[model samples]
Target: MTTYRFSTGETIKHVVLILGALVVLLPFYLMVSTSLKAPQEIETNRGGFLGQQEMMVDGDCVRQGNAEEDCRQRPVVYNYTQAFEKAPLLRYLLNGVIVTVSIFIIQVVVALPCAYALAKLRFRGRSLVFGAVIVCLLIPVHAIALPLYIGLAKAGLTNSYAALIIPWTISAFGIFLMRQFFMTVPDDLIDAARMDGMSEFAIVWRVMLPAAVPALLAFAIFSVVAHWNDYFWPRIVITSSQELFTPPLGLREFKGEMADHAYGPMMATATIIVTPLIVAFLLAQRRFIEGITLSGMK
Candidate 1:
């Protein structure tokens, strides 16, 4: 009886979880579906899914020839061609890659050391500083945008990639994450490395870094995703040159210049913009999950 009850409980839990996952995934499914759909189908079909709710205009569609066109499906490839040829899509992608990689690399250099210091070294105002970082995590980027922009302008960094990349190199959240992961590292390990004639820096590089591989990788993914998907900062800083545009900005330009309200090309541009992030996640899925799951949790 107990075994049957356990099996029943497990089955119920899985069914609930699967439903929840589907619910969460529905929006993404729609985005991809609509992007692949013909422009006419998008206008006519109030809801794309077979059994989804939609507003019915009681024969309005049938009354006009456009009613059929509204339900007409577009060839997905044509939308993509229009999206790409209409804008500097390739330049946008290259610029995005450069800025995103720069942000993550610089973040690692700044974050890792500060994280190590907070984790291992004894110092004055340490707890206070840690508290400040935690507080900073609560603050949104928009709150600081104006001041940051002014400072960058004054420092002559405006209109440069430095404007986008430098200020973000030292992330307070990254420090918190690294510190939490480092705390889990045994103190004895550091001491042994010291006894073996390893300096503090050497110990950090040789001992702790190797030990913190998962956490580092986790942060790298987080850093890449955050910066790569971000469009606002790039929009603000990079204005003069089309060459500096990123994927998101490029897609926006495509929509603005060519579409004027054309949904097919807009959808195609969106699909192109998101493809890299999706591919990255797919390829590094295990590492990304493992890193986040274990880091700072214990």
Candidate 2:
């Protein structure tokens, strides 16, 4: 058989892609590897990729009046166990789920109707409203954080779940994406629903919402990921409330409370926090890509 050969351009492209993949994956590799390594191995940077897999004594456990024999564990076990035990990680995860889901649901509820109106309804100043949405997209959240926080403080919504969920309920990007996708739907569908005596509100829910699934899925991924990984806003709003801390904020608080050398647990916590988004992306990757692509076609 003849040897397979790639063109020079193909070879260069493959090389470039490989390099890019490596660059992106490097931090993930380090995070997992460091999480597996013992404190000594991490400090010395000596254990290689899988780490030594050696039994390590947990100094903190020993100091807590536990027997030395009980304190001895594999580095992986110690790191992960401490990550959960030292903090209310379960509560933090629950709070993350609650906040992320609540934000996504409210965003969809508020955005979908607005998007339908923008796409299908002919009303005065509709163009102005669409322009306002586009302009809001251009304004970074950080620019208005001070005013938002001040308002929340005045309203006494700070230090609660409302603080985390309320500010993010209205997603301009969500409205824009959904609106663009809705614009692509044939007008005949809406006319048919009207012919069947469906109210505009009924048509919005029954006809438009289902048709916009791809875009909604895409927006869901965006909304969930953004809120899930959001530390800055949560940290700002959720002051003095450990019970309401999201995963990122909990991880931050965990780091602050840990000793300087708790890299293993810290890395483990980060890995845990990051894993859900990775899993979600992997599972719905096809839908996610299709959604983004479809939304952009209009």
Candidate 3:
């Protein structure tokens, strides 16, 4: 005995949101579709969604004098196999884990205390220091890239893990986000901690940190995604080190290395690279939404 309906504006908003989602997801669909398709299907753009998935012969296997029977495999299998076999995909994945984890850990260590101080402490020039952090948020990474690269080069730190990790140790946005979240926390909690003989450091770690878990999860996603997908800075600093190449840099293997570009395997590699982030976001989706909603409540 109940009827539900949307108003005209609400219906229009829903339609627009659905269209925007399709636009965002279309590239991912094509990447996954192409990864499953044969080269002929890809070139012709004939595959529907999952592709024909017909058996295809790998040219490299045949060129290496393998039997035709042995060389024939399904397009999906060929593409994924070539993705891992064509480069040190596992090594690149490990490097991504290392760099992203390192940067996140360092950023949390630095940002949490800075956020705590900015939010809780009343000291001289506190507003000025906080103003500086806000200013830093406005400065784009590209604006400071040359100076950071040159400083690293001068210090003989280029091509090392330090080069990757050091530049991102202090994240201004992380500090800002955590500070805003901390402002929403009750001042009584800090006073209680101080009554318990807890120093400022202890207050930050014990009092502020536990309450900031949602915000930290939100920051972690941002830090990990940015560093994991970063190719430009890594390309500049790790020019000579293949061992140090992140997942994004590893895609270069399929670009111009072979006589013919391996679009299927390249797409497969991209799919592989993006899978973890998607899984992570799904797992943290609730907390991420909660964090964003609660962060600006002050």
Q: Top lDDT: which candidate number? A: 2
For all predictions, the C-alpha RMSD in Å is 7.6, 2.6, 3.1
> Whose TM-score is greatest here?
2
Backbone clashes, each candidate: 2, 0, 0
How well does candidate 3 match the true structure in TM-score terms?
0.86
Model 1, which residues run further than 4 Å from truth?
Answer: 1-74, 260-262, 282-298
Q: How do the residues 65-127 of candidate 3 rate in per-residue lDDT, one tens digit apiece?
A: 999999999999999999999998989999999999999998999999999999988899999
Candidate 3, overall lDDT?
Answer: 0.87
Worst 10 residues of 2 by lDDT: 289-298
Answer with 1 or 2, whichever has the higher lDDT: 2
Whole-model Cα lDDT per candidate? 0.75, 0.89, 0.87
Query: lDDT tens string, model 1, 211-269?
Result: 98877888887777778888888888777767778888787676667643356567767
TM-score, candidate number 2:
0.90
Model 3 residue 103 CA deviation in Å: 1.0
TM-score to native of every candidate shown? 0.73, 0.90, 0.86
Model 2 clash pairs? none
Ranking by TM-score: 2, 3, 1
